[model samples]
Target chain A: MTTTARPIRRRSAFMRNAFPYFMLAPAVIFLLGITLYPGIYALYRSTMTGKFKLEFVGLQNYRELIVDSTFWESLYNTLLVGSLTLAIEFVIAMTMAALVYRDPWVKAWRIVFLLPMLLMPSAVSYIWKLLFNDGRIISDLLGKLGSTLGNIDFMSSTSLARMVLVITDVWQWTPFLFIIFVAGLQGMDKEVEEAARLDGATWPKIFFNISLPLLRPVIAIALVLRGVDILTMFTPVHVITQGSPAGHTETVSYFIYRTAFKSFEQGYASAASVLVLIATIILSQTLVRRFFRSGTEA
Target chain B: MNAIRKLTLSLWAIICALPIIWFASIALRPHNEIIAPQPIYFPTFTTETWAKIFAEWPIMNYFKNSLLAVSGSVFICLLLGIPAAYALARYKFKGREDIGFYILSTKMMAPAAVAIPMFVLFGHFHLLDTVWALMLAYAAMNMSIVVWIIRSYMMEIPHEIEDAARTDGASDLRILWSIIIPMCMPGIITAAVIAAIFAMNEYLFTLIIASQHAYPLSVALANFSGGSDGIIYNAIALVAFMAFFPVLLLVILIQNHLSRGLTMGAVKG
Candidate 1:
């Protein structure tokens, strides 16, 4: 009886251990079917170059991508817009987070603040496109602010168009960073901050030293997530600028999109897509690593 | 110092609210007034734009399509995400952490990166220009978020409750249905709401996959900007307002869950 029970017990343990994979099967299979398979297929398609008839060109598409000035320009634009937006968003969100962390009334106003983030991106882009019109509210407001802005087309000028894209992004996304920062601030150990204050640490010192370090994980996560998103920003550019004025506002994602759909260069677009995937992976891995390290330390 | 801070915050709030307020005003104004050079910060009210949106545009069809896509995506997320979240939360398994990271890493890949491939795949399967394609794409896009959010919530529930249920001869599914799910209702709801909002707002994949047949409000509103009548600002505003209103209301109602949801529980309020 004891010998028979022992085998049964071992078999039951095996079944119990296998239960998790059973539970995980559906999600894994679904994601594999949808995301992973398609991604791998894209990578495979990137090597071949042809519209209708396929020809395997070893590294040819990638070589062309390297020499492609337009691709490089879009890449540069993506980075510039992404970094500028991040810097502005971080500063504003951090300041606002600091201001609102303790005030009950202000904390309650988070919902209002988050309104922009909540709206559909396309809708936000559409609304901003209208506002950026030559004689619209935004232009009039700028004129009122003592600038020689006489019917300036915001989207036609390359510099102004880029600035407008950054501003619109900052407007829509700062609230998200603000919410995260506020949450990070609230989640901090009050004792450490109060102790620092009692120890004659100035507010700025406490912020720079204690609060910032403590909030590193949240900030890092926000930066990476927002960075990835900003890099892929499409709707605003597509709707407002359409990558016009000599394609100055064209982002990497938008360029890839136009290449794939508009120009129908599936092979080259796939090559670009593979490069994007690689960049995303490298950046996400580094950022997520930093986030995890800080998270564990905190 | 406190007073100065308060003043600054109030000023910032006004700045933040300005565009939205302007948007609402534009949406309500007469078309001629919208194009008037003298910026109408506050407009005399009119509903002609809204009236035209309903009567002339296929706004309702857009709304219905948006509803179907969002609901289908959310349903898929919940159906698949819940079990995976449960396993991650409860059971210790080989490659558990790796699997979790893999799921999250999938999100880092932008939808555009896979757009061409997905387009081809859907086209091959004759799924293009269908809401089902949009639903499936969105479901794939949002599944990671659902798992992450719901798993975080499930982790917060004590394991002893499940242990007790197991001792009482309840199967894992039974405990999940009877005990675990009931306890994690708020988390599930938050996950579902976030997924729905994402699906509703999804533009790129929808734009690529479904042109006219499955065009949601996002595509419709985008198309309005390039309409033949040449940029009726008020009508565009009205359509934008209509497209945004439902999600805005939902966000306000569930504002508590939203902050945490948006961050995927990275920062808890």
Candidate 2:
């Protein structure tokens, strides 16, 4: 039913409802000014191809993207990074959260684990870049221990650069996953674990049978949030790699960068964005639905 | 078994704490010692590098950009977010769930993907290289945050409060201003804090949209590390400390709310 046509049960509903609308008005203005203007502007630009002037090319930009090598490479790298990072984070966060909850020293351990949450993403990415920064400093340090690369080139190589990136990103963000997982644990009633233990359940059995099932929503939330987050890998790839050594490290973000600002292919970039937007929406909805369901179910 | 469990816990904690320690060690080291073949056991700390950070870059401007962007995004998000969240939580409107997801799905979309178009579009509109652009960009970026964070918090407060406010002759608007908002204060604060941190360290949009005059500390930090004289690792470390210290301070202060929100507020409330 339409908003206006809906029947009001009581006269007070209107008066009471005004508060939420009133409360929401400023937020509405805030979002609209930022999201709508930019979104519409992007949409408008997606239709045009040349100079400051607008030319409507319809779906040509979208058609070009299908054949664009860099676009496909970026798509490949984004999936590769996002999926892998999520897998690693999920396993570690779940196992860590489960184990930590059993300890009496949880408060102290929990606090320490959460420290990285405070570190800026940019800073974390920086440290990762530093960790793999040429691996020269590290290799030399390791070299002193009699470990030589032999014929192995580290950062200069594509595979090694990508590996360094995944490792670094995980190092920086695992704390976030830890925090979320712990929060999920804390929200759970203690009796569930206590009851499982009373039933002669082993710790591993209890975890798989009871705790894991209970924490599915949290797991889902962590995965979805982290999964979506990794797709925009920019800082390290931008600063550390610059999609370097023959665009081996190029992510969708970097691809967009080269196209729009670097190549001035506004239409093409906008077309790529529409596809990105669709993928993001589908993935986010699936993950968030699980989050919403768990919230309501709990 | 007991020892194994304890060891496992300790191992995890060590793994978690090591990176921050690495960062802290670098920050504390003097230039001569920072990038050494072997790290020194004990180090002398100097403010000279940090002092130079301010003197060299438009740090204050960057700070302003960060503060403005974070505060701007948070304020706007709260303004719009509180309402949308309220509508979804309290009302049984048709398509409410869809609407909520519609709002939140934007969060899933990679900023980098959207950013490509934005960079090009901003150039065409002659809006390139402005703090206002950063502000505008941040506002959109933060919409999902405001909506989710505030909505969850609002859910915690019972609808009966609004019902009671209605019987007392309070209009919907009045009830939200007087009752609902005050109740959600902590959550809104959390959103604002997150926004602040995101804003302060935000490198991408600011780096793209704004120029040298508007160059933020993050960009300046990147520029300085390589260019701030290759020899003075101490100075660069000091600069690194300057760029990150404030975020650390914020996280420490608001650690409780932020931690709480991250875990359950969005999902459980």
Candidate 3:
């Protein structure tokens, strides 16, 4: 009887150990099959040449990517667009967040503020495309401003086209950052802030030294998430610019789309994709870790 | 200070609403007014544009496709994500942290990184140009978000209730179904709503993996811009309005949960 009871106990313990894996199985299997497998397959295909007859080119695609002027330009454009969007979005979001944090009426207005972010990216692009039309209100206003400088076609000129892309991105994403910062502000310890005020600390001093430090983790999370998104921006460029004016407005993701679809250079596109994947992984991992660590210490 | 705050807030609100208001105005204006040399700030209202959009384009077909794809993908995400979320929330499992991080890392991988290979794979499986391919791709893309959001909510549920149920001889699946699910229903709904929105908005994968047969509103609206006649402002505006309205309704309905939903429980107020 004692031996039998011991064996049954051991069996129950084993089942308990196995239960979590059973629960986790479906998600893990689906992710691995759909996402990870395709990524690995893309890496493998990147080293090959030719589409139906397929021969292993062994890094030839990468070699071309190294000296590819178009690729370089697209990369530069991606960084430029990404950084500008990040900067503009951050400043506006922070200012708006500071103004409206804990204000009841403004709090009620958040729903309206989030409309652009909530709309489909494709839809956002379409809206902006119309606004950027030569005779549209936005273009008319900018045109008036441009007469002082020079002629301006928002979608045709290289610099203005890029600026339009950045503006559209900022309009859509600022509310995302604003909402996060507002939440961060609401979550702060009011006692500490009040104490600082009682101790004669000025508003700027308290904000720069206290509130900002406490909000670092939230800020970090927002930056990394939005950065990844801005880097992969495709819809606006695809809809509004289509890399017009000699590919000046082409983002890296749009460049990949053109290569694979228009040019039918699947191998070269795959090579570029692998490079993108590496860069994204490295950037996210490093930034998240670095910010999270500093946030905790602060 | 109060006056300044009100002015600033009002100004920002106008900036925020300007594009959407402008787009809607174009959709309502007559065709001639849309193409005039001067900008039409206010034009006579007409439904001609909307009538033309519905009459000429397969707008209903695209809407149906989008609805089916978004609902299908959200259902799949919940089906797979709930159990995994429950496991991470309740159970003490080895490799739990690693698994959570892995799921999140999948979200960081840009869709373009795998779009070419997915196109090739779909070609082999004959899944290209079908709603099934879009549904599957979106389900995989959104599964992590479902897990993260639901898991955070599930963690807030008291453990003793589950323990009490177990002591009454309830199985793990039985407890999850009978006890845990009803309590966590709100979280599940939030996750589903957010996932649905994301799936509806997806463009890159849909553009690459689907042709006309499974084209969603996003793709259809995009193609409208590139049509042979080229860039009719009113037509594009009508299509854009139609595309944005459903999402606008959803966001307003769930405004209270919008920030929490978007952040995936990261920055809760």
Candidate 4:
């Protein structure tokens, strides 16, 4: 009985050891097929040209992107719009989080705030389009206010078009930062605040000197995540403006979509995508590494 | 201070609620009223636009496609993510940290990079323009989120319970099924809900690959526009509301877990 049990026990131990790997195998394989394979294929495709019969182009696509003024314009627009959206979202979300943090009467209002973020972004873009279109809600409201905003075409001017993009993004995404900031605020050590209060720190002083400093990690993580997402803003650009005013408001994602799907310039699009991928990885890696380090420490 | 606080709170609340209220109002208003030179604040509400849109477009077909593709992806995400999450939570193994970071990094990848090759590959395999294509794309897109959220939840469960089950000679699979899963039901549900919301809202991949038969609500809504009569604001609103309503409901249901969902489990609310 002992000898028979030993062999079965050995087999079971092996199975136990292999269990984790067995569980992880499917996800790993699936992710590789979807992410890694495509990523490597994009790299290979970036160096080639032609539709049906492919021919090698070496660095020609990259060279073309370097010279393409529209490519540069799209890149600039992405960064400009990205920064504007992040700045507005951070300010509004932070204010709302600060005001309502731990307030009993206002606690229920959090759900309402989250509604905007939960709306489909595509739908949000359309809603904004309806609001900002010529002779629409925004123009009507502006006209009521006795301003010339009613006559101005928001989608025709580059700055105004970008503003519409930024507004749509902020309306949809501010709640993401709001909820995270609220969570961070709640997760803070109450004792530290109590100690600060006991030491006669004013509310502003406490917020600036104590709370803001302590919330740095959460802020960094939130901003990094939001920034990365904003880098790929496409739907608003597509649905609201279609990069109107001569592609002045075109984002990199939409530009890539047009290049690949519209023009069938697969190789050129792949090159642009690779550049975007590199930028994304570098941006996320530094911030994510710090986050994980702090996470493990906590 | 209390008056000031109330004032600030209500102001922000109005800011948040007004757009959604107006959107629903638009969906129920007459077409001429919606696109009038002056915005009609108190137009007579009607469902004629909704009726018109339903008649003109295969709105239900698109709705069904969205439901099928999103639900299919959510099912796949959980099927693979749960076991992978369990492994990450319970085991300390070689390359564990590296593998975990890789998964998280994939979540950050731009959709464009993958979209190009995926479009080509799907066409190559004759899988383009199908719900199955959307399912596979969305599953890959959201796998990281499902894994991370579930893993974070799994970590919250104490290890002693699992150790006891192990001592009783329960197999790992049996323990996970009978012990861990039932305990982790809330996490599982949250992951599924969040995954569904993201999958349902996904536009780029679906737009690039799905044409006629596979157009989810997102694509269909984007393509829906004013024909010769000018921009049809009311009909667009109806379709937009339809696209978002289901996820909006799911989001409300998982309110407590939302920060975790949005941040891919980086912050717990």
Candidate 5:
């Protein structure tokens, strides 16, 4: 019995060493096929030019991208829209979360607030598109209020069109931040806040001194996740504005899509996509490191 | 202070509910009333648009297609994710943390960065315009969150049970099947549900890969507008409502797990 057990133990030891890799292999291979391989292929394609025929061009696409006004405009539009939407979402979501985080009775609001996010983004964009249509809900409401503003097309003006994009994004995503912040608040240790309160701290004071600092990691995670998403900013532009008014409303994602599919400029679009990808990696990597570092320290 | 809190919550709730209410109101209005010269604030609510959309469009077919694609994607994600998650959670191998971060960083990539090449690859494989393409794309897109969430759940399980099983001469795989899987069933279900939501809501990939045969509800809804006459607001609204209703219900059901799932378990709800 002892001799038999010894061989089995040896075999099992070999198995234990091999097991984790065996379990991870299928997933890793699949992920590589879908993400890494495609990403690398895209990088390769960005340097070559052709329409149904391929010829290598060294950095020509990137060089042209430098002088492309449309590319620059799309980048500018993406930054403008993305920053505005993030700023509004952060303020609204943080305020709302702070207001209701302590209330046990407002649990239903959580589900209600989550409704906007559940809708397919395409559907959400369409809903807003209809509401903002000529003589539609928003326009009609404005007309009823005796404002001449309702008579003009919201999509025809650059500012109004960009505003529509911002409004749509804010409406859909603020709930995401709100829910995360509420969870962060609830999961925090309450003793610090209670101690501060007993030390004659006001609610606002306790919140500022005790709660906010502890919540830094959570805030960082939420903002970075949401910021990464808003950086892409595609569907509303596609469904509602279609980057109209001389392309003032075109975000980077939409610009890439239009270039790749609409004009069939595959190599050129790939270059723009690579630029966006690099920027995102740099931006998110910094924030993610900061978040994890704070998380470990706390 | 309490009054202000209550007031704030109530106001936000109304603000939250208003757009949906407006959508429903438009959905139930008659087409004539919708297109009337003056905005019909109090048109008699009718199911005519809903009925018309159902009768004309193969709504159920798109519904079935969406269900098939999303469920197929979630199944593949779980099949791949669970073992990887368990390995990362329980094993102390070299570079395990790096491997986990590698998996996560894939999610940070913009879909645009990969879409053209993938489209070309699918064209080569003749996988374009098929449910298979959508399923594969969704699985890839959702892999990171699914793996991390499941890993977090696995980490919560006491390691002593597996240790005891090991001493009893049970193989690791067998122990995982019989012990860990049942114990982490809630986490598995949460991951599946979240993956399904993202898969179902996916539009850009579906739009690129699927044109006719594999059109999910998202792409189908997008194509519903701009008929012969003009934009059909009521029909569009009805289809949009149907597109969202399933995910909306699923989200409400899984409200407690969302924050963790959304943040990939970085911050537990």
Candidate 6:
């Protein structure tokens, strides 16, 4: 690894000064090998036929995606789940983070909030699946909550199943939002808040006018991260409903998974992946600009 | 006001502890007493569930696979990630912004999208179901994070040390090993902890690559609980307990990094 290389002494002092450029060579190589190629390759595959004819299909794959029913359903479900999860999580998580941000008594709540985050999402899904299967322990307990709760199949209702998934996702991940929000709040310039308080600004006014604006950058970042996260979520629906009772719970990721693996339609899957990737990039860029144009960094 | 806050904390502790305590007790309790309606708070001890966990299933194999894949990624991340991150941090060069964006963009990538291409790659290499395949996928997925976290930390280190080292006869790699690596230990540990936990808890990639013999503990544990059929409550609870134990211990041991990963910048173990 430490084999000697030719020095840049032959060049002017300016060019020679950049000799350390060689040090950066490997990282760029690895990044290109792993990311740039795959990203570009996905786009390339998206434009080709899957039957191995390798014929160029061009934008037809994009057209098929527009008309693809499963793609639409999955896309709709992804959006629905993302929006619902985000709105609910932000409110609850913000409240929780504010409450626990610097509290000495928060040691336990912090653990409780983060416990599910530690478990693999797939594991969390299975646990919840076991806990909420129609005749499972939770349903059995809810049986006493009311007869309807016991009688109904929790995973059967398209709306209810989606709701459960959204709720489970919120339960498992609210800690992530809480932790970030808490850090954002804790890291704020306390002197600014103290100055506002000396001016006798009401707490609500001070929070709305002061704390939240400072938190916008982080909250936007949290939103983008969580939005993409919930959008691509798969394990829960896979374990809990198997996208079942109907096709209601399958997200775009699962749709892509089944298309590629189950149907052996690699071209179609590639196209779908390209579309999802494009959507994600566009959404991410918009959110990035929204939160970071005035700032910088991903 | 103070009393109210105390009451809230006390209440929340019970809420949090209830599920964890209940799960732990479930693992230790014998089969017959598990379903009793009265609920056995203190049960007679037996080697029953733990012994059954080992004897009846392939958890030990899963355990081994998880450790190997996780540790393998940690080693790879340290070997390859540190030097690269240091360069990006200290050196300002053309395409640096693009390179950083390119690295982070991978963090947002959906595992499902990569599943097919990576699986096809594994097939081409005949690596399916082998630990190597899982390790390769993990290394690829975690490369972005390993770079990002390490770079951020590396930026904080003074360049004067590197300049001083360059003034000596010391080679670049030697400077890295002797000067940089030791100084960046805390940051390296933070990044390693994040990557190791990710590798340890990762399921989707393992599901695609690792089958019965090669499966990680999480995937195997899920299958153990029940798949198409419903779960056997007692047995599933025991498996859940088993699954949580190692991870819970890791979080406690590396509480700071664990919190840092969850939070924005810093928190403590």
Residue B120 in candidate 5, Cα distance off native in Å: 0.7
* Model 2 alpha-carbon miss at residue B4, Å: 2.6
Candidates, ranked, DockQ = 4, 5, 1, 3, 2, 6
TM-score of each: 0.93, 0.87, 0.93, 0.95, 0.95, 0.86
Per-model fnat list: 0.59, 0.45, 0.59, 0.59, 0.55, 0.23
**What's the TM-score, to 2 decimals, of chain B in model 3?**
0.95
Which runs of model 1 end up more than 4 angstroms from their true locations?
A: A1-11, A289-298, B36-44
lDDT of 1 by residue, B59-138 (tens): 78877888898899999999999999888888777888778777777778778888998899899999998989999999
lDDT of 4 by residue, A58-155 (tens): 99999999999999999999999999999999999998888888698545879888878767888888888888884377877787889874466887
Off by over 4 Å in 5: A1-14, A292-298
In terms of lDDT, model 3 sits at 0.81
Report the C-alpha lDDT of model 4 over B140-208, residue by residue, as the tens digit.
999988998888888888889988877666777888899888998878889999889888889899999
Writing each residue's lDDT as its tens digit, candidate 5 over B207-240 gives 8998888888888877775757466667667777
lDDT string, candidate 2, B1-269, tens digits: 77887788788778777766766776666566665555454667665556665676666666676666566766766666777777766665445666666667666667766675567667778887766677667777777776777777777787777887776567556777899889988887777767666666566787788776555556555655555446344433444566566766666666667655554355442
Regions more than 4 Å wrong, model 6: A1-22, A40-62, A146-148, A284-298, B1-47, B168-171, B225-243, B257-269
Q: Which candidate is the best by lDDT?
A: 4
lDDT of 6 by residue, B1-269 (tens): 55765566556446445555555555676765654443345778676667765786776677788888888978877777787676666666666666656656666778887776677678778999998888877887777678767776666678788777776556666777898888877778778877877787676778788876678766775665444433444555565556577777766665545544542232322
Q: Tell me how candidate 5 scores on lDDT.
A: 0.83
* Cα displacement (Å) at residue B184, model 2: 2.5
Give candidate 5's error at residue A64 in angstroms.
0.9
lDDT tens digits, residue span A79-163, model 1: 8988999999999999989888878786467876777886778778867777886337677777799778667788778888998
The runs of at least 3 residues in candidate 3 whose Cα sits more than 4 Å from the true structure, single-residue gaps closed, are A1-11, A134-136, A143-151, A287-298, B226-228
TM-score between predicted and true chain B, model 6? 0.86
Q: How many clashing residue pairs appear in each of the predictions shown?
A: 0, 12, 0, 0, 0, 3
The residue-level lDDT of candidate 3 at B155 comes to 80
